[model samples]
Target chain A: MSTEANRLPTATLPGGHLDCTGCTHRTDDWKTGPTATFLGLLLFIVYSTAAAFQGEHYMYENYLSPMYSPVVFTQLERTVTTPEGETLKVAIPGAAPVEHAWFGLKPDAWPEWLPFSPAFLILAFPGAFRFTCYYYRKAYYRSFWANPIGCAVGPFRRGLYRGETHLLLFQNLHRYALYFAIVFIGILYYDAYMGFFRHGEFGVGLGSIVLLLNATFLACYTFGCHSFRHLVGGRLNWFSKSPLAHALWKRASFLNERHMFFAWLSLFWVGFTDFFVRATSMGWIPDISTWG
Target chain B: MAERTFEIWRGDRSGGEFKEYTEEVDEGMVVLDMLHRIQARQANDLSIRWNCKAGKCGSCSMEINGMPRLACMTRMNQLPAEGKIKVQPMKTFPLIKDLVTDVSWNYRQNERIRPFKPPAPDSDGKYRFQQADADRVQEFRKCIECFLCQNTCHVLRDHRKQEHFVGPRFMIRVASLEMHPLDTDDRIPDLKNEFGSGWCNITRCCTEVCPESINITDNGIIPMKERVVDRYYDPVARILRAITGGGKKLPTA
Candidate 1:
């Protein structure tokens, strides 16, 4: 820690001054920015609203809970060679049914004591959103409502905006919250595992299978998350020197680089999984079987 | 020729107005061309910052239609004829004047990024890395520092933490160079605690505003943020990172 401060830039450039070599006069301060914050807010509202209503997020085609859609294989009887002399072929006797691991939200499982678990999940959507965000608090105050164009408006331009530190600092909870997120995945796997063997006696069913897949996709998305990787060991010295640490860092970087894509995809899949489970469990849609 | 109007902002720190300028439009005309014509015929002293109208240099970034963009890259034809086009400076920095903000803060934050400290090479002092390892991070280097992404970023725009959070675009710069396999820098924690790397909410405003089309959120910011989380919070990785000396650790299920 002591060495870090020594090596760090002094935060001041000695003998450095704003010479303004080519320019002339300057006088305006931060307080003069007009209320121009509505521009981004309006656009963001429009986009988020659109994203909400259009909720067809990433969903496994086979996990819709109504039919067992099998993987389509088209290589039953043919092969072709590329100009580069690469031969590729794939053939399956029939559409292979997707196997399940865990995830079952049985009607019987809904004990009265935990009656709100389903509804709670819905509310959790925005809750998860605020907790995991890396930029919203700043954007909300600056561009969402006040003004998108940055011009300070308070007298002396000093008070137009000042960030809140405590709430944001508390946001560090994302590290611990990741534990719950992982546990939820485990719960989902249990549901799927039950669904595979249950022959329809009020046991695990299609809902479990769909939920399991949702969790799997979400895991791919979450484990690859950028924030999660940072808490492990991003800034230490000899502490992170092991070969295992090196391997994990490499893998985390691989996943973290695609954080946005996975984030959005997983978010949508969670919603999709929930809707499928709801429709079937509520009897809004029949739990038909595709396999005899 | 259709006539068009521009609400060109005029004046300096003390005071200014949305001075309107009207110009004749013929065929292919760009925003810079309109400004040139205005400079020739109308307000000669209209102060605007611009350079390399070719779009490679990020010199002319401003809010076009309320979004941060390069004025030189926007075409007069793309805007709706019925509505007005509003142009302003990027949101997060101090305003120097119309469409120009003091971007010096970005460079200041860059100076704070933890200096590179790669593991010592073999006794021979040789390092090896394949092209595949360098390509993704290389994509982030196309940034011209136009500050459009910074302008578009909501964190710096709304949150008054310019002194703390370095915003996503700068994070991308830090992540790209530091993540370079041969480069020996460990910027993960400085990115998290000091630079406020966690402040970004993945809104992707930077990705959208980037003229270079770099995936600011996907490729640069998040990956670095993830590494920061691994080093600081994950128990297993924390133990591993302690032994490794600032390399990096992974996460578990």
Candidate 2:
């Protein structure tokens, strides 16, 4: 052992430095992963921003974009020519009267202080939930923040990391945000219910299916939450005593294993739901109904 | 007679190269068995560290086929028979010899965590804790100190942020101590500062490589993070605690 110790090199390699120049240990898939994440998030941001601003195209018949669901307020009025060629002017509560027939819920005018889209008002809840999601925290931290960019990869920020300690202390609100997300799931499901009713009679349309899928995907993402698993049965000593919570936790754990998949799936499908409503509402696509 | 080829690292700290050896391996034999055979039949100076061959001691941690795992637990049948399996010392730590990395850094880290100390005994002159409360920390105690989580942790492995970040093994250590029901020492400040619980990004890589299947990230790190947040970040909680002198109290058992 003494001889072996003597044979060992005396020089030790220095670590924990702030420099990341030309590090050799970065993963092979490093560039591709961040590039995809950057592009994907960027696409969602640009599309969602534009769709939020283009408020006229967010609703078709009873179908609504999950983004602008439970319309708190609207500043929209339009002139519509029905299939029978009768023109009518309809105005939502917040906007000036114009020659159009408006559909769906019309609430009191949005306070003049908040100027953007109605979608902007409600999206923050889900966005905060995703921003602080355990899986999404890794995704954005690696891809967007470039903090040690990938698993064993060279990172942009090299030195001491605070890691949601101080500046991102609000991230601790994730469990609280789960409450909002759960409530939104119910709201969106309500919209899905509204989607199936055109003129108070039961009807199924392509837009209804889109809204249904948006609710399903969002439910998967929300139910698969790590905090939900903890809230259900994480600290329990015996699973046998509380079988219902244990079973729910087992199901949540099963879903938590695929949390990443559901996260991406919900993100994409929510975006698609917005696009579908926008396109059909603007006459870019026909609202093909089963009965009609 | 199935002959499996092994590409083993064979040198010291300065440099090394993969030296190939073809060994006749048996069914139900693990990679450690082949290494023992090579040490006995071919090279006597082949150095490797192991104690309990049943995967409990955690002294046998090495990278097999570029994955950090215990050699004794890895069955030969699980490996692809066609390619040469490489056994290298864990890249996270300094190497001393062939297949033996100097893991003394881990022991030093283990020392940083404050051990459990039960408060002064009750009126009966004995410490008491409910089985339910003890069971809360029992899951984290399953760690065998294999340091696989330490070796696999990205903050330590890739960034080499050892000075700032305590790896996953010691996170479990800190979690075990902090969750003890009868223990009444607060380690949250140290966890935030010296132990570097904040540096963990909750990637679950450590939990994935854990041989004990301990939920190191979800159960240990995240909960500790919540405690840190409750103490340091939540202004209302902090102010209320300042007024009430209550912070992260275990229910009286």
Report backbone clashes per prediction: 74, 6
Candidate 1 local lDDT, B48-157, one digit each (tens): 67889989988887766545678888888877675444444554566676666678887887777666566688788887555645565678878898888776564565
TM-score of chain B of each: 0.88, 0.95
Instruction: Tell me the lDDT of candidate 2.
Output: 0.74
Kindly report which residue stretches of model 1 are placed more than 4 angstroms away from their true locations once superposed.
A1-165, A173-176, A179-183, A186-190, A196-224, A227-285, A290-292, B90-101, B112-127, B192-194, B198-202, B242-253
TM-score for candidate 2: 0.76
Model 2 DockQ vs. reference: 0.20
> Per-prediction interface RMSD?
16.9, 7.9
Could you tell me the interface RMSD of model 2?
7.9
lDDT of 2 by residue, A164-231 (tens): 65587677767788999999999889889888997788989988888898998899899988778766
Model 2 Cα shift for residue A211 (angstroms): 3.3
Q: Which candidate is the best by TM-score?
A: 2
Please write out the lDDT profile of model 2 over residues B1-253, one tens digit for every residue: 8998787777887665567777898879999999999988876899999999998999999878756789999999888758777777877888888898889999998888787878799899987655655665788888999888888777887667899888888887877887675667778889988988777887766886788999888778876776676667667657877888775652221
Query: TM-score per candidate, in order?
Result: 0.61, 0.76
